[model samples]
Target: MEPPDFVRFGRAICCDLVQASRREWWLADGLGGYAGGTIAQCLTRRYHGLLIAPANPPLGRFLVFVKADATLHDNERNWPLFTNCWGSGAVEPQGLVHIESFRLDGSIPVWRFAIGDLILEQCIWMEREQHTTCIAWRLANAVERPVHLGIDLLVNSRNHHADTRPYGFNSIIEGNVNRISIGRAGGPTLHFHTDDGQLFARHQWIEDFDLPRERERGLPDRDSHFCAAHMRLPLRTEWSGLVATMSTTPEAPATDSPLRCGEMLNRRRAHDAARLTAAVTLTPELHDAPCWVRQLVIAADSFPIVQPVSAKETKKELNEKEQDRQGRFGQRKESVIAGYPWFGDWTRDTMIALPGLMLTTGRYASARNILTTLAGFVDRGMVPNMFPDDGGQPQYNTVDGALWYFEAWRAYIAVSNDVAALREIYPLLQEMVSWHLRGTRHRIGVDASDGLLSAGDSGIQLTWMDAKLGDWVVTPRHGKPVEVNALWFNALMCMAEFSRLLKKDAEIFETLAKQAKVGFSRFLKPAGGLYDVLDGPEGNDDSIRPNQILAVTLHYSPLTPQAQAKVVAETGRHLFTSYGLRSLAPEHPGYRGRYEGGVWERDSAYHQGPVWSWLLPHFAMAEYRVTGDAELAQSRLAPIHDHLLDAGLGTISEIFDGEPPHSPRGAPSQAWSVACILAAWVTLERARPSAREGMAKKEESRQ
Candidate 1:
C-alpha cells in the first residue's frame, strides 16, 4: 500500500480527500467523522458541512461522510429537529436531511442516509486482517432519468452531540459509549454515541457526486440537519447490498417542482456499485485530481483539520484556479521528500517546527526553502507572525515570532553549516532589534527605566495565552515579562555570534552584548531572585511563572548558575504542576480548574492556571542545566512524554487545565507544542551528563 500523504498547510495536517459539488477540502483524524470543523466547508459557500469527532487522541480515521440538507437535532431549545445546511443559492432556503448508522457485523458498521432526491450508503470495514478500518461511501442513482447531480460531504464532529446548541457540543464525553439526546423544546430525544474506542482504517469512496448547471450548483441551507448512529460492529456484513431509490418527474420550463427522475431511481444496486468502483479506480488518474487528496490522507487519522494549501491560496482561491495549481505543486514537491504536513502562513510555527518536522527527518532542502520563504517576509528586521489567510499582507503582532526566527536560523545553520544564510539574516535581526527599541505599539516600549524592554498594556497577551478579552489582559505582566527579556538577551547573543562568523564589527558585538548584560542585571530583583516583571511601585507580582525559566535556558544570560538555580528552584516550588508548569500557580487564588465550560471562563484559566505541556520540556531543560540534576529533569519530562502519547497521539497540545487532572486544552497538534517537545528532546539528549566528553569537544570547536 502507498504511504498516506501528509500535507502541511500552516500548522495543520490534512489527511484525506473528497469533493462534493464544486467545493473541495481535506479531513483530519482527531476531529472525528465530520468532527473537523469549517475546514471542510464548501469552497463556494459557508456552513456546508459538519465535523463530528473527538477532541483528544486515538485519532481514528476521520469520515468525510457527506449528504444533502440533513436534519440535525437542536439541543438548545429542545425544539424539534432543525436543518443547518448551507442554502442552495444566495436567496434560497435549504431543507433538512437525516443520517444514521447501524452495525451489520461485528466488524462492520453500515451508514444510512435520507436526503432530498438522494440516498447515501456507507460502511466502516474493519479489516482486522490488516489492522485497519476502511470507511466507504456510495451514492445510489435516485433520479428518474440521468439528471446531473451534485452532492457534497459535510461532517461536523466539532459538536460531539448531534444537537443544534453549540454549548452542549463543548462538553466532552469522557466514557466509552457516551450518549446524548437531541430533542425539540420538549420533544423525544434521539440517541447517539459520542465515542467508540476503535480506530478507523481508511475512507474509501466508490463514486463522486457530479451535478451539472455549474452556476446553479450550491449547498443546502443553514440549519441543514446532521446525525450519526455509531455502531460497535464492523459494517462489511451488516447491510452489504442495501439501497434506496426515489421517484421524480422532470419539471417543464414553467413548472417550479423539484426535478424528478422516477425510472432512474429504480436502477439495479449492483450496477450503481459497479459504476462507483470504476470511478474510484479512475479518480487517481483524472486529468485534474483534486488538491485535497494529499492532505486528507495524512489528516485522516489526526486531530486539527489540516489545510495543505499555502496562505497565499486562501485569498486567490476565491476566484481563480492559480491557487489550486500552486497547492498541487507544493504537495507534489513535499511528497517526494516525505515531508510532514506544513502550513506556510505561520512563520513562527513553520520555522520553529522545521528542524524536527523536516530537517531532522531529512528534508534539508525543504527546510532551507522554508527558511528562505520566511526570510523573504522579513522586512526592516521584523519577520511576520503569520501570513494572512488571504495573502494580502503579513502581520507582526507577536514580539517573539522574530526572536524565534533567529533561533530557527541558528538551528538551520547548525544542521547545514550555512554561514552565508546566517550572515544574510543578521542585518534582518538587527532591524528587528531596532524595531523593538523604537517601540511598536503595546508598551513593549524599550524602558529607559531599566534598559530592559517593557511590554504589555496594549491588551495583547504577547507571552502566549495570547487570547484577548476586552481590556482585561489574562496573564498580563504590564512591565516586562521574563521570557521576553530572555529572548531579547539571546537574540543579541545570536547576533554577536553571527557577527563573529562574518568577521565584521567586533566592537559592535561587544557593545550589544554589554547592553544585554546590563538589561539582564537591572531586571534581576534585589531580593536575590529574578522577578517575573519590572513593574514600578506595585513591584513584581512574584507569581511563579515559566517566563523566568528562559533566563537560564537561553544561550545568553548575565545570571550565574547559582542565580539561575535560585530562579529555577523558586519557580519549581511554586509553579510546577504534575503534568507541566502551570501558567499561574494555584496559590494565586485566581486559578480555575476545569477548562470546558464557556469560552471566556475557559480562557481565563487558560494561562492563569493551565498546565502547558509544551513548557515542560523547556522547564526540564532549564532544571537539568541549572542543578545538573539529570534525575530531576527526567522526572519532570518523562511523564509529559507519556502524556503526549496518551492525550495527543504522539504530538502535544497547546495548554491544559491549570487544576488537577490537568486536561489538555487549546489546539491539539499545536506547532509550538511540538517544537518545544522536539527541541527539548534535542537539548536533553545532547546535554546528557554521559555526553560530557562530546559537549567538551563541541565547546572546544566553538572556542
Candidate 2:
C-alpha cells in the first residue's frame, strides 16, 4: 500500500533537539483515549503518554502507560533509543541525535533513527473504539548478527488532569514471559503484550521527571511513574513491538492477539485507508483536495465519540412516533470533544464545529446525533456550555451555545435535507427560543425595550471569550454581547425558515426576527463597525474584536450590505493575522499580546489578544460576502494549510500568541480550529465562479 502524504520533517528539524521537541504528534482512539509525544520521543508535558484511556467510558480518564524507554544493546555497548528530560534542566541520553527523519503516515507517527548501518523505525497508534495503543519498532535496513534491545515499561494510574505523585497508586505488577499486568486494587488494570519479548517484573519508582511544557504553563513540572516491568526483545527486518490496553472485557487484549507485528501495523494502515476512502465516497470533492486538507479530514474523525444516552430518559417525554424515530437512530449519541488532552465535550465547540467536522466531511449521521443529543439536555432554553469531565451534570453557562445550536441545525438540514429529523428537532429548537424570549439561567434573556439578547451576570463569563481565574471573570461581556445578538437575530430568521418549511405559522418568527434586526442596529458604532458590547456595566464597549465579524458571516446577517462591508474592512485591518484573527486588537488597552505565564496571567490573556483559528472561518465567510472575491477570501486560509505541519502534526492548534511568530498555545489539536478552517475552505471552493462573476458585473456597472 502506498503511504499517505501529510507531513514530513528531515534531519534539519529532527536533528535539532529544540525544533524536534517543540513539534508534537497526536493520535486518538475515538473513545476519548489518545497517545502523544514530541518528535524527540521525550515527555515534555504531564499529558504526554503512550496510553491514556477513560476509566469511566468516555470520562474519568487515567494515564495507564507512560513510556517505554528503549535501549539498543549490541554486544557490550548500549545505546539509549529514547529521550528523557530530568528535573535539573538536563536532557539525558540525547536520543534525538540518532534521529534521521520523522513523518506522519496517515494518523500514525513514524520516526526513523539512523545508527551506523542499521536504521530503526518507531511508530505509535491507537485502535479505533478501543482503549488499545500499539507501539512498534522495525529495522528499516538489514543488520548483520542479532540485535538485542531492553525496554523499561513505565505505567501510571491517576487522573489525567492531575500532576503525577510518587506512589500515586500502589501498583501491583504481574508478568510472565511475554505478558505484563499493572494496576492497584479496584482500579482498571493495563495489560501489556509483546509479539516477541520476555517480560520481567520490576516495580521501581522513577521520580523528578521534568515536564518543560507544564512548567511553561506554570503548572506542576515534576512527575513520577512506576517502572512496572522490563522487557528484553529482539529486532528483525520486518516489525516487532508491544501493545498496551485497558480493556478487561470478554474480548480483552484482542487487538494484538495474533501476535504478529506486521499484521498489527497493517490493520492500522487499513483502518486509516478506509477512513480516507469513506470520506471521498461521501464527499467526492475531497478526492481532489490537497494532501493537507485530506489529512484534516482524517483528523476530523478523532473528535466525535460515542456517548450512550438512556432510552428511558430520552423517550420519557416524547410521543410514540418520536420514540420510534429515536429508536431507529439508536440510543448512542456522539459528541465532539472540544480539544484533546484536556477539554471535554463542550456544547459551544460541538455546535460551532458540527458543520465543518461532520457536514463538510459527509458524516451526516454523526452530526444529527450530536444535535439531537444536546437538544435533549437543553434546559431553560439554554444548551449546555460544557459537560463535566467526571461525567457529571452538564453546565449551562454560555449564552451563545444555544444560539449556535440554531445555526448547527440550519447547516445540517442544508446538507442532509432530512425533513423528518428536522420535524422531530424543530419543536425543541422552538422551545429553546421560547426560553430565551422569556428568561433563562445566567441572566440570559432578550431585552424587552431593544428586542436584543442580553446575557451574563457578575462573575459569570457567558460568551465564548470566557476565561476565568478564581472568582475573576476575564472578558466580562455581561450585556448585549455582539455575537450573541448576531446569533439571536440569525436564530430567529432560521426559525422563520424552518417554520415555513414545516408548513407551520412563520409570521410570528418573521416578526420576531424583524424586531431583532432593528434592535441589532444598536450595536453599530457611529465610527464604523459594531460595538463589542452594548449597555454593559460601563456602557457600550467600542473595543474592536472578532465578534463583530459574525454579524456579517452568519446565514441571516442583520447588517446591511454597506454596514457588512465596513465591519469586514475594519476587522481585516485591525484583527487579521496570518493564522487567524486576534481576540482583541493591539490598539485596545486591555489587549494582552502574549498568552503565557501562570493561571491568572494566561487566563487574563486568553481572550484579550490571542489569535483564534476557529474565527478564521467567520472572517473568511464575511470577507467573501463583502468582496465577492472567492480567491482573495480563500487566500486568507493559506497559512493554516502550512500550519498542519507545525505544532500539531496534521491538526490545528486551539490558539496562537497574539504577537509575531504566533507561537501555538492551548490544546494542540482543537476541534473547531480544524473544523472551521476546512469548512470555510470548502465553502469558498463551492462559491467560485459565481462569486467571481458577481464581482465582474459590479466592475462593469461601475465603469
Candidate 3:
C-alpha cells in the first residue's frame, strides 16, 4: 500500500543499462502535453523528451526542449549523467553507471547521480496547465572543489511523431541575456532561463538518435535535434543547485523555497484523491483504500481534458427561437482522450470511459459536459464514432456509441440526482430511440421481427472490433452482434427507468425492452454459451468470444442467473489469462494467436486473439454476480498490479499479446483500460463484507 514497487527500480537495477533503459516515466502538463524518458536517462521513443507541448492547446504537438545532456565534473575526471543511443547500436557515455537511484515522487520523476564524493539529484516536472518544464538540480553532498556542470541545450521544432533530418534549419542565439530566446525565422520563440549558469553559443546537428519503441512500431528508428546553446553551472557547496526552465514566456526566478514544484504536483494529486473519496461517501468502509487505488485515481485525471467546441459550430447563425434555447448549453465542451502518443478522442472510448474517469473521480461538471457535448453531435439517432484531431466534422459510423449514451446518462443521473438536466435532454433521448427503431446509418436499426439491433454493411466496420486496412475489414462482424443487443436492451430499460424518474409515460420503452429480451433468447448457444452473432450473412457465429460476458455484467441483463453462470464459466475455461480475457478462443479455427508486425498485420489480429484489459472488468463483475464472492472476483485483477511497474508506470495498457506470458502492446496508456480497472477495484471495495457489516452496525445503533 506504501506505493508498492511502482516506484519500479530497486538498488540492483540502478546500474543495469539494459533493464533501466526499458522502463520509462511520464509527466503530464494537464493540457494534452507531456514529457517522459527512460529510467536510464536515455531516449527510446520519439515521444520521450523534456518538453512535448501542444502549440494549439491539444493539437499541433511539437517537441521543443529535447534534452539537457548533463555532464558531471569531479576532481580530475568528467562523468556523463546523460545516456545516449546511436543508430550504430552503441550506447555512448554509459551514464547509468553513475549508480544512484530513480523514483517517482507522486507524478514527478527524480533521478540521483552519485560520483566519487559528490551526489547530484535532478528532478523534471511541468507547471500545472502550462507548457513550461522545470529541470532542477541540487547538490546532495558538498563539492569541496567547485564542480563544473556542463549542459547542452538541444531543441526541436517539428511534429513529435515525425523524425527531424536536418535540412539546414538553424537558430540564432543572442548570448546570455536575462533569458536567451531560441528560434528560427517566423517560428515560435522558446525562452531558456537559468539561475546560475553561463551560456555559450553553439550550433550542431545531433543525428542518428536511435528510438527502439519506434522500431517496434515499424517506423523510422532514427531522429535528430539541434544543440542551440550550452550552459555551465558551478557548484562549490552543499544544497546549492541550478534550475533551468523552458517555457513560452520566461518564468521569473522562484523567490520562495525551490521545493514548490514537486510539492505542488503532490498537492494536486492529494486534492484529486480527496475528491474521489468524497464521491464515494456512500461506502465509508472503502474510504481508506490501498495506495495503488489512489495512484489510479491520480492517473485517471490525465485523460479528461477541456475540449472547446469549434468556432464554426459555435458561431453559426441561428434563428431567434433557436438562440433562446442555445443559452442552456455553452461551447466549453469536455472529452476524454482515448490513449496517449497516438489516439485522439473517440466516441465509444469516451462513453466507455465516462464513469470511471470522470464520475468515479467526482468530476461531475466534466461528466455533464461530456454528455452534453455528445448530445450535440447526435445525428440520425447516432453519436459520432470519433471527432477528428484537426477539428473537422465528427464521424457517424458507430452503432454502439449512441446506445452507450443512454447508459452514461443513466449512471450520471442516478448519482447526481439532477433530474432537471435529464428533463432538458429527455426529448433528445426519445428522438434517438425513434431513429434507431426507424433505422439510421449502416442499416443500424431494430429488427422488426426480433426487436434486436442489427448493423454493418460491405467494406465498413461498425462494431468496436472494427479494424480495417484498405478495403480488407478484419473480423467483419456484419450483423446482429450479441453485445449490441445487450446494450440495446439495457438502453431501453434505462430509458424506461428515466421515464419513471421523470414522471412520464414509459410503456413504449418497457414493451420494447421485453420484446428485445425475448429476441435475445436466440443467441444462447446449445453448448451453454452465447453466440458471437446471429442473423448474419454467414448465419449463426458461435465463436465463443468475450462479448457475451457483457450480458451478465451490465446493469440490465437479458440472461437468467443460470445462463449468466454458463457464460462466465465458458469465458473462464478458454479465454481467461492473467492479464485479461483473449479476444478469440484459442481453439477457434481462424484465431490469430499473437499480435505483431505492421498496421495490416497487427490489425488482422487486433480482435482475432489480442487480450484487452478493459474487458477484465466485465468478467470480474460477472464472476462476482455468479459466485457472490468479492475476494475471488478481485483476485481476477491481481496480475495488473505487476503490470503497473512496467510499460506505463501507474497505469494500464490498451492490449496484450494473446499468448502465454502476455506482453503488453498497443497504446502504453489507455482511457478505458484504466477506467475499467479502477471501476473493478471500487466494485470489490464496495462489496467487501466489512462494508456490509459496518452498515448493519450503524443501522442497529440508530435503532
Candidate 4:
C-alpha cells in the first residue's frame, strides 16, 4: 500500500522538502534555509532568489542563490541582495559557486550555483565525517507564478536569544561593491554597489558556537529582529520538483571505504523521492464549506504531489482513526504522512498541531504517537517546548506549553474517552503544576496570596508579546498576567476533571477546584471587570487585554457567568482589532500603530499594539459562550477565518499590526493560531441549543 498523502498527515499551511542527510529543507515558498538543532536560520536576506543551501555540516554554513535577468533589473538603481552572515567568515568566488568559510569551525565551505534568464540551479554540499546532507534547487523562469516564501525568522529567534543573550548575526553583502546602504523601503530592503561583472557571497556564523556560553551571556540589549528571506521563482516546467539528497556513514561497510555517488544517491532517493514529490501536492482547502467542516480536502493537482494511504495497513488504520477522533473535536488537518517530506524539529508545534491536523481528521493512533513522543520528553514533569534540530537537549522556556499539553490531553480524552492515558499522565500533570507553583526558570511562580500564577519580569517573555528590545520588555506585565491566571484556573479545573475521570483522589480534585474558584473570585476587579494583571502585592493595574477570554472558552473555567460576560464585553470594546485582538489596548501608552518597517520598529509594534491572529479563536469562543450569539460570534470570526484563508491559505499567521485592516507579521504557518481556529471551528459546528436560543433571543430583543 502507498504511504498516506502529505495533506492527510496534519493541517499545515505550508510544507517543507527536507534533505535530512544534507540537513536542509526547502519551504513550499521559494526560499530555502538551514535546519539547525532548535533553530532554522534563513540563508537569503531577500526574496529575489529561488534557491538556498546549507553549505556546511550541522547547518553552520549557509548560502542563497538567485537567478537574475536584465528585464527584472532596474538600470537607475543597483539591486542589492542581503545575506545574513554571522560569526567570523570570509567569502570568495569559486568556479560556478561561492565558497564561504570559517576555518576553526569547518562549517560552511561551498555554495555553488548557476543562474540564467529562465532557469536557476543551486547546490549545497557539507561533509561531517561520513554523514552528508545536500540540497539542490531548480526553479522555473515564469514570472506569473505565485511566490512561495516565509518571513520573520529573526522574531522567532527572539525567545531563544532572550534566554541565551547573545549577539545576533547581521547582514553583509560581498562583491566588488564599494558602498552598501541599509534602510526601510515599503518593506525592509538593503541597497549596495552592483556592477555587471560583480560576484559576491554572504554568510552569518557565530564567533563562539557554544550553547552554554550563549545562555550564560543572558539577555543582550539588541538581538536579531525583523529578519526575513523570500524567493520568487517563475514556474515554467510542468514537472518541477525539489530534490534532497542525504547519506550517513554506515557503522561497518562491507568494502573498506564508505558508499559514494550512485549507490548513496540511489538509496537516499528511493526513500525521499516520493516525499519530495508529495510535499507539493498536499496543499489544504481554503473554503469554509460544510464539507470542510468535517475535514479539509487537498487538491490532487496541487504543486507538490501526495500519495494515498490504504486502510488495510495497521499503521494506516491507526492514523485514520486518530484523524477521525480529531475531526470530532474539530481538528481535521493532515500531518505526519508516511514517506512525506518533513522538518526534523518543531516537536512542540507537531504535538500541539496533532489533534486538529491528525486526530480530528481520523488518525487516532498517530495522535497517540505524537502525544507519546512529547510525553517521552517529560523531564521533571516538563514536556519540551522545542527540540534542537541537531538532536541536542530540548528547551522548555514556554510557560503555556504545559498548559497546552493539558488541553491536548483533554482533547484526546474528548475523542477517545480513554481513562488509561489520563491515569498515566496524571502524575506528570501533577508534577507540572507543582513545578509551576514552586517556580521554574525566569521567575514563573504561583502566588501563595492568591492561586493566580505569576510569570515574566525575568527578561524572558514566555507568553506571546515575546519580543524584547534592548533592555525594554515589549509588553512587560511583570506580575500576574491575566492569561496566566486564566490558564492556571483552567489547569486546575482540568486536573480536577481528569482526576474524576480516572477515579483517583476525589478529595484532592475537590480541593483544587475550590482553590481555583477562590482564585478566580479574588482576581476580579470592581470597575475594570477582569483586570489584565494583579502585579506585586496589590491587585491594582486593571489593563483591558484579551487574555481574560480563556477563562470562558476552556472546557472548565472558574469564572462565574457574570464575570465571564464582563470579560467578553470589555475585551470586545477595548482590545478587538479588525484582524484580531491587540496584545495591548490603544489606550495604553506603549501602543504603536504601524507594524512594518525596520527591525526595532516592527518588534516595537509586535505585542505592544499588534493584533495576534492566534487570539481570534480564543476571543470568538469567549464571545460566543458569554453572549450565546452564534451569529454574532460567527460574524466576528468570519473576517478572521476569511483573512487566514485568503492571506495564509489553510493556515493562520502569527500576528498582525493592530492598526486598520491589520497587516500580517511573523511566520505564515503558526501552530497555536491554527489549533485555536480548529478548536473554535468545531465548537461553532457543535453549537449548543442554549447558544442558539440565546442568539434567537438577542435577535428578538433587537427586533
Candidate 5:
C-alpha cells in the first residue's frame, strides 16, 4: 500500500516554515478523537496536539498531551527535531529546515529529517476506538555510533476549546524507567508507556508558546504546557515509540509489556489496506481512478465516529437485538463530525456528507448507523442541527436538515436497495413531513397558498449560509430561501418514491411535490437565475448566491431543462471560481473579498463572498446535468486535486477566499468539502464512456 504521489513533499515544501506550517495532517481514532499538527511540527491552533480525546465520550474533548518536543543527540552535538513558535515572534530550533521529505504514509504523517550523517523519521497516529495516541521515531539509516533521543514530554489537561495557564492545577507525576503517569487530582489521567525508554519525572512550566493561527483568528495568542517528564531512548533502524492513554476512571495496573512500535505501524497499514480493498470491491470505478481520488477515499474515513448514547436517549424503544449490541459495545451511535479543531456532529453537514463520506466508500453499515442515530433525535419535523460539545441536549435550529435527511435516505436506497431498512424508517419520515406541512418550531411550515417551506425569524439563521456573531445574523435569510424550497421539493418527491417502494399511499406526497414544484417557479427571476430569498422582512432578495444551484443539482430537481441551464449559466458567469462558487457575486454591494479580521468581521463576510468548496460539487453536477458533459464537469474539480496537499494534507478545507489565489481558510479539514467533491467525482465518472460501458456490460449480464 503505497501512498499517492500527490501527497508526498520534498524539502522545497517541508523546509520552508510558511509552507510547512500551512500544511496540516490529521489522524482520527474513529471514536471522535484525533491527533494533528503542521508539517513543521509546531502548534498553530490550540487544537493542535498529540492526544485529544473525549472526556465525555465523543464531543467533550480534552487535550491531554500537547507534544513530545524531541532532540537528536550524537557523539558531540545535538539538534532539535521539533519546532515551536514563541510569543515574542521567534521560531526556536527552526526544526523544519532539517526535514529531507514529508509524506503521508497512508494517512499517518511521516517526516524524514537529514540529521548530519543519520536520517531520522517521526510519525504520529491514534488507536481506533480507544483514547490512545502513539508517536514513533526511528533512525531511517545506519549511524556511525550510538545516537540517542531526548524527548521533553509536554502534557496538559485543558478543554480543547480553552487556553491553559501555568500550573492551573496541581499534577501528580509518578513513574519508573519505562512508564509514567501524569494527571491532576480527581481528573483524567494520562498514562505514558514505551517499549524501550528511560523515563524521569520532572516538572517545568513552558509558557508563552505563541499560537499564530489563533491570533490570526482574533483569539488569545498565548498558551502554556507542563513538562511532566523527560525520556531518553536510542533510535534504531527499527521503530521505537511512546504511547499515551487517558483513563477517565480508575484502571488496573499495567503488567503487560507495551506493544512494539513496529506492530502498531503494521496494524495501521493493514487497516488502511483493508479500507482500500473494501472500497474497490464495493465501488469498482475507484480501481482505475486517479491517485488523488483514492487518497480522498482514505481521507473520508476520518469523519464518522462513535457518538456515545445518552442515558435519556438510550431509554427509547429498543428491541432485543439493539439491547444486546449496546450491552456488548457500550451505548453508542454513529455520527459525523462537521469539521476538525472546533466542530461537533452537525445534522445538516452529516446528511449532506453522508453519500460521499460513507456510501461512495463502501461504508454501508456506518451510513445506516449514522442515519439511524440521527433519526432518533428528530423533533418537530427537523433533525437536531448539531450536538453540543458539552453534552447538552441536541440543538434543533435548522430548516433544511430534515429536508436533507430525505435526500440522504434516497441516496442510501439508490445504492443499497435495502427495502427493509427503508420500511422501518418510513414512518418517522412521514411524521417529519406532517410536522412540516402543519406548523413546527421557528415558524417552519409549508405555506398553504404556495406550498413552499418558510422558516426563520429575527436574529435567526436556519440555512447553511448561517453565520452569526452575537445578535447579528449575518445571513439571516428569514423567509423561504431558494435552497430550502428546492430541498423541500426534492424531499417531497423522495417521499413519493419511498411511499411507492414501501407499498404505502403515494398520492398525497405526489400532490405535495406537484404543489411545491408550482410554487418553486416563483424563484425564477425575469433576468435569469433565482431569488436568494422570498417573503422576507424586506420582500424578495435578488442577491446572486450559490444557493440557487441546488435547484438544478438535487436528485429530484423541480426546474425544467431550460430553467436549469439558465441557472447554471448565470451562476457560472458571476460566482464560479477555480476552486468553488463564491457565496455572493462580486457585483453585490455587500460582498467582502477577503474572509479576514476578527469573529464579527469574518462571520459577516463568511457568506457574503467567500468561495465554498462544498458548493463546487453542486455547480459541477448542475453543469453536467445541463450539458451532459461529465468530463468537462469533472474538470471543474481539478483545482482541488492539488489542494489536497496545500491545506489539510489529503483532506479539503471548509472555505477559501473569494478572491484570486484563493487561500484555504476556516476548518482545515471539513466533512462536506471532501464529501461533496468525492461524491460528485464518482457521480460524474458514471457518465464517462468507460464507466458507461462497464455499467452496460453489468446490466447485460443481469438480464
Candidate 6:
C-alpha cells in the first residue's frame, strides 16, 4: 500500500525530534492486537511495540517485543538506526536526525533513513488476526561500499499496563541455524525467524527507559527490557530483503521478500476500500466527501474481534443475578475493542458504534454478530457496561448502556430489515424494559410518578459522565440525566413500535411512552434549553450542556419542535466548538478550559468542559432537523474531516479542549467518535430536500 500523498511527511516537516515524536502511527492486526510507535522511531509510550498480542481472546494484552535497536554499518563508520529515551532524560542515538522522511503505507509505518549516499527503508506489519509480526529492512539504494546492519532485539514479557524494572526475569534465549526462540518462564515464548542473518545469542539487561507519555498519565515512567539476541545482515534489496518474523508461532524463513508483503497489504487495503464503496448509497450525490471517511471505514474494521464465550462456565464467573444471561455464553461472537493502548469491550460504546463502523461499511455479518454478542450478555435487564482490563467479569453499573442497545437495533433493522432476528430478541427486549420499570441495580428504575428513569444514589455515578477517581464523583448528574431520559423515552417508543410490528400488546409501551413525554416536560428550563438533570436531591441541574441535543436527535424525540429549536440554538450559542460540543458551557464556574496534566487532573475536567467528538453528530442532526437544510448541517461536520490528520492518523479523537483551537486529547482513537461522525454523514448523504422549503427564510434570519 503506497502511502497517501497528504499523510506522507518530508524532512522539512519532521526535521525535529519533538515534532516527529508527536506524530504517532498505529497498525491493527484485526485480532485485538496492534503495533505502534512514534514517527521518530522512539518508543514514547509503553504501548509502542512490534507485537502486543491479546493473551486472552480480546482483553489480556501482553507486550512481547518492545523494539529492536539497530545500526547501519557502512564499513567506515556506524550510524545509529534506532532512538531511545533514558531516565536521565536523554535521547540516545538520535535517529530522528537521519530520518529523511516517514509515511504510512496504508496501516504500515515506514521510515526512510539517509546516511551519506546509502538509503535504507524499514517497515513493520502484523499478520491478519495473528500474533505474527514481520519486521523488514530493505536496502533501497546503495553506494560503492557493501553496507552491513546490526540489530539487537529488546524483549519484554509483561502486561501492557504494568512497567518492568530489573527483576529475576530470566528470559531464556536459544538460537538455531535459522530461528531463535526467547522464553520468559511462565510468560509467552516468542520465536524469531530471520530470512538471512548470522545470529548470536546475547543476554543484556537495559533499564531506566523513561516513558514520558506514561509519566503524563501518572504511571511508572521507568521500564526495562532484556536484549535477547544480536544479528548482522548484508544489505540487499532483492526478494523480501532482510525479513524477520517475531511471532508467537514458528514459521519457515521468508523467501517471498518484503515486496510481496507490501503487495498483500495493499490488496487488503483495496478490499477494505471496495467494501466501503459498495456500502455507500449516496456516492454520486455527495461525491465530494473527504478521503478520510473511507480511511475511517478501514480503521473501523480493526476494532471488532472474535471473542469466544463458554456459555456453561459463565455462571461461575458472574454473580447470581446473572445466571440466566450466562446460560448461553458459549459462542464465537464479535466484540469491539473500544480503542488502542487502553480499553476493553464496552457495551455502551459498542452498541453506539456498531451501525456506523459495521453497517456503514456493509459489514452486516459483523454488525449482527456484535449485536448478538452483547445481547447474549444481558443480565438483570442490563447489558455489561465494560469488560475489565484482564478479561474478567463484566461490570454492569451503567444506566445508559442498555438503553443504547434499543437504538442500535433500530439503526441495524433500518438497513437490514431483519424482522426474524428482531422477533428472536423481542422477548429479551421486553425483559429489559420490565427490569427497568421494576428497577434494577444502582437505583436505576422508572419513577412511578413521573414515568421517567431515575438512576444513581449516594457515591454512585451511573450516567455516561461517569468519571470518578477514588470516591470523587466528578460531574455526577446522578438522577435523571438529560441524555439518559431522552434515551429512555426513545427506548420506550421503540418498544411500542416494535410491539406493533410483531403484533404484540403495544398499548402498555405506548401508554408508558406518553407518560414519559409528560414527565420529561418538567426538564424544560424557563431560560432556554433543558435541565441537565431533574428530580435530584438538589432539585435540578441547569448547566448548559450538550446532553439536551439528544432529545431532538433521537428517533423518537419527546421534545416539541419549538423546544428542539431552543435546545439547538442554545447549544450553538454556548456548547458548540469547531472540534465538537463541549460537555459544559465555558461560562460555567466549574468549567475547565483545557485537558492536560496527570490522570486525576485530566479526569476532573473530563466531563466539565472537554469537547466530545461523539456529540457533534447529535448536534449536527438536531441542527438539520431544526433548519431543514442538509447542506448546512453537513457543512458543520466537514471540519472534522480535516481533524483526522490532527490525531489518530485517520480517525477521530475521544475529546478535545473546550477552548478555541480545541487541542485533541484523551484516547487518540475512539469507537463512538468514529461511529457518530460516520453515521451522521451517511444520514446527510441520504437526506432529501425538505417538502417545506425554509433555506431562504433560515438564511435571512441568520443574517
TM-score of each: 0.56, 0.94, 0.92, 0.57, 0.96, 0.91
lDDT of 1 by residue, 230-300 (tens): 22221121222111111011111121222221211222223223322332233222112222221111221
Candidate 1 residue runs with Cα over 4 Å from true position = 1-355, 387-393, 441-445, 448-450, 526-528, 536-539, 689-703
lDDT of 6 at 80: 88
Tens-digit lDDT track of model 6 for 1-703: 2223346788975658777776777776777777778777787788888888766756677888878787989777999888888999898878778888887655667788888788888877676766667776777865666887888888888888777767658877777745788876567667776656777787898888878877877777888888888878677774232233434433333434344544644555575556556555423322334566656665676677775332234414556645454344324677787877687777788888887788776777777777876776788899878878665676887899999999988888877888887897888999999999999999899999999999887776777888999988887787888999999999999999888888899999999999999999999999889999998879899989998999999999999999999999999999998878999898999999898888888989999999999999888899999988887888788887678665567667889999878988887888888888887887776684641244445547879
Instruction: Report lDDT (CA) for all predictions.
Output: 0.44, 0.85, 0.78, 0.45, 0.87, 0.78
Q: For this target, which candidate reaches the highest lDDT against the unseen true structure?
A: 5
Q: Candidate 6, overall lDDT?
A: 0.78
- Give Cα distance to truth, residue 196, candidate 4, Å: 34
Clashes of 3: 0
Error of 2 at 348 (Å): 0.4
lDDT of 4 by residue, 675-699 (tens): 5566566566447565557656755
Ranking by TM-score: 5, 2, 3, 6, 4, 1
Task: Give the TM-score (vs. native) of candidate 4.
Answer: 0.57
Give the per-residue lDDT of model 5 (tens digit) for 42-133.
99989999899888777788998988999999978999988999999999978888999998888888889996678999888887777888
| Candidates 2 and 5, the one with greater TM-score | 5
Per-residue lDDT, model 5, residue 656, is 93
Candidate 1 vs candidate 3: the lDDT winner is 3
Q: CA RMSD for every model?
A: 16.6, 4.3, 3.4, 15.0, 2.8, 5.1
Clashes of each: 88, 0, 0, 49, 0, 5
Clashing pairs in 5: none
- Residues 1-703 of candidate 3 have per-residue lDDT tens digits of 1222346465477688777877777766666677778888888888888888765656556787888898987667898888899999999988888858887665667788877678888777766666667776768877557777888888887777777868556675663633566766644556676555677767788898998887877778888889877888776433323333434433333434445433544554465546556545543443566656666766787687675334344333555744554557666777777887666668899899988887776778788888987666677898888766566667787888898899899889977998988998898899999999998889998899999999988888888998988899887788899999999999999999999999999999999999999999999988798999998898989898999999998889999999999999999998988888899999998788778776667888899998999999888989999999998898888788778778777778899998988988988888999898887878786797976687688779979
